[model samples]
Target: MSDTLLTDLHVKYIQNLGKNKDDLTYHMTAHLRMNAVYWGLTALCVMKHKDALDAEETIEYVMSCWDDEAGGFGAHPGHDAHILSTLSAVQVLAIHEALARIDVTRVVNFILGLQHPSGVFAGDQFGETDTRFLYCAVSALSLLGAIDRLDRERTVTYLASCRNFDGGFGRVAGAESHAAQVWVCTAALAILDRLDVIDVPTLGWWLAERQLPNGGLNGRPEKLEDVCYSYWVLSSMAILNKLTWIDSAALTRFILSAQDSEDGGISDRPGDMVDVFHTLFGVAGLSLLGYPGLDDLDPVYCMPASLIERMGLKKGWKALPRRL
Candidate 1:
């Protein structure tokens, strides 16, 4: 996409939110899926206009989504909490340098409450388990700097159960493999410091099969290409240290083709609606392709350069084993 188009889309996304007055608060009318859009949009806006937005104000709005009683975040103040909303809440705060404002211990406890004895994570107290919850749990724990709070061995074993013989991961044990599940599994393994447990070469082969002739990736073999899967499948390969196995040039072209010039965002496919969710992943995909003006994002942990620096984490950020 042209530089001018990218700039325009970014501007449009920010403008769509309109002005925020002192008494203004984000309406909590949507579910967790919609909350992802809010946090994603907030992060995108902050990145685009750091000086224009009051970082403190933006942070407070995002933090309002946290449901302290439920020990997880929700779409709005009174909404039920879930792992997905909790992850987005933390990520948006981290992006805005507001994590220090949160109660780290409480957040960690909330995340720990979602873990099942079998190593899978449920979304909340309701016990809805899925691969997406696993991703949220891993990511949220990593953000809080408290991943060790979970039973790592059990979690790893649970992750292993989700791996299919086809060299991909599934939402649950014995389920069909999917590209999104592969991303979650890959990221979780990276966070747990056990990516080696899976057969990287075989998994990489399965992921490669997702690439379509149009250059974007599909959720499964023989599926049509979509922009979101580009980040899911490509980032999984990056986490596995196997990004080179895919055609970078072709994927880059596909992502660029989905750019909506009139607005400042990307869509799942050409002629689709542009939103913050796909826009962030779309930029992330470009960053993976070594795009200029973007920092090198950690494939395993999706935090930006600033937060990584603040944590004093080593370049690769591997977990150190405890001495016996």
Candidate 2:
């Protein structure tokens, strides 16, 4: 109820997410099952309680979602493999140090196979392309240490085409700039060491403007603030080394105010229903803002900073100093 993170309650909340399988909401979200696991697991890690979820059981569930026929992961058992779910599967395995359980070579090939001639990636065999899928592919390959197999120049060229005059990026070439799209393109460039392609000051200014008078951030101009943008906007700013451009204290308060005091999660905005996605992004934003009693998040990869550093993929992105 206070203006502070409900750490224990959130950990318990995440712990219970997979227990109610018989609930209608659980079946309704089968398409997001893998992603929901990733979000819950990562949120627990940020809370410094990765053990809250049993590693063995978690790994088993993740492996069950594997589409052996496609060599990638599906959102849930019996679903089609997708780049988005594939990335989530990879992230969950990496966090639990269980990547060895899957065929890295096959997964890498599956991801590489999704790249279009234009260099963007599709979500799956359906062929819907977007910068988000590109990031998922890039991030997954990087985690598997197969990034060298990707066409770096072509990827960069496609990202460059998506850039807008306002210094932000869109889902595709010539589309209007959006915060979420900017994050994927910017983060993918960071993974490729291609930040040089971005107009730093111009993009930084555009990102800073996402923070509104309410202290929360909107995906774009004329949009209402959402907790998820806490990650999209702040992570991009941290990567750009422009974190100070926004009001950290105000943003922190805004995120905390959106907490589900009784139920133990965070929502898009204050008084909204809480879910794992917004909860992770909200807490991650606080960590980036230097809130006390939290772990550092690698803005570039959206993973634990120490884990990324241990793997030698840590970027030069900045986060506010953690309060003692």
Candidate 3:
């Protein structure tokens, strides 16, 4: 399960954007906006391979995605500002140690503006609310050292309402449980020191059930496996203090098999396209499994060594108890 291939592919993604190009402005197409996830992935990969990246230039590109008008960021220039992208943008900048380049006060205000009266967060000004946006809201605030900007009590109550009868979390209240949403909601609670509010054991059991015979994890019961869920489910279980409940060895095999040896990244499945999104998560999954080549990732934030240090938050298994 050596990740040489995966790292190489990620480097290629970074390279494809061209040298000295602003990542925030470099979109695959003119109509498609630069996305926060892309910048986040770029920042993570840059941190992972600092010696290999033009760090300062890359950070500048990530910062360009910030949309000062709407009090949040967009995926790229000309895109609507959104909580999800704003979170990624802030986290990426933090990871790059470039938080100084951002207007912290305005960014904080932007995140605060997205919070509705009910404690639910809209993804953007359009009022599309979801648990995913809630995760972004919390995570962005955490990265900014601005968690105080959020109404913690109301936010936690809203997150609790998204919990489904299946013991997993959903995108919104009364929606069906989903693995990605479960990760977002669980991580939000962990970051807020409210993990005990959920039925940990039941959620852990449901996450464990997502594992397929092929060694990959799926989003929900009976769904096909995807590489992205490897991070979603594994990180959630890790935050819950229940990684032992899942088959780590089998999942590792599936993740490694998805690597495109020639291209240098892992795909969603064994023969699929390799992209930055899966590349970061693939490494994150390996880190969760205690893979030798990588360092331990924060189960809640999914950030790397440097950015976590910059935040100076509590770390390791002990931090888990504090959340409880």
> What tens digits encode model 3's per-residue C-alpha lDDT throughout 91-191?
66766677888888888887788889888998877899998888888888888888887899999999988888778989889999999999999889988
Q: Rank the candidates by lDDT, best first.
A: 2, 3, 1
Tally clashes: model 2.
0
Best by TM-score: 2
1-324 in candidate 2: lDDT tens per residue?
Answer: 459899998999898899998999999999999999999998999999999989999999999998989999999998999999999999999998889999999999999999999999999998999999999999999999999999999999999999999899999898999999999999999999999999999999998899899899999888899999999999999999999999999899999999989979999999989999999999999999999999999988888888889888988899999898
Tens digits of per-residue lDDT for model 1 on 103-123?
A: 888888888888888989998
142: Cα error in model 1, Å: 2.1
What CA root-mean-square deviation does each model show from the true structure? 5.8, 0.7, 4.3
List TM-scores for all candidates, in order.
0.87, 0.99, 0.88
Where does candidate 1 stray beyond 4 Å?
1-5, 18-29, 33-53, 313-324
Question: Candidates' lDDT values, in order?
Answer: 0.73, 0.94, 0.74
Ranked by TM-score, top first: 2, 3, 1
Candidate with the greatest lDDT versus the true structure? 2
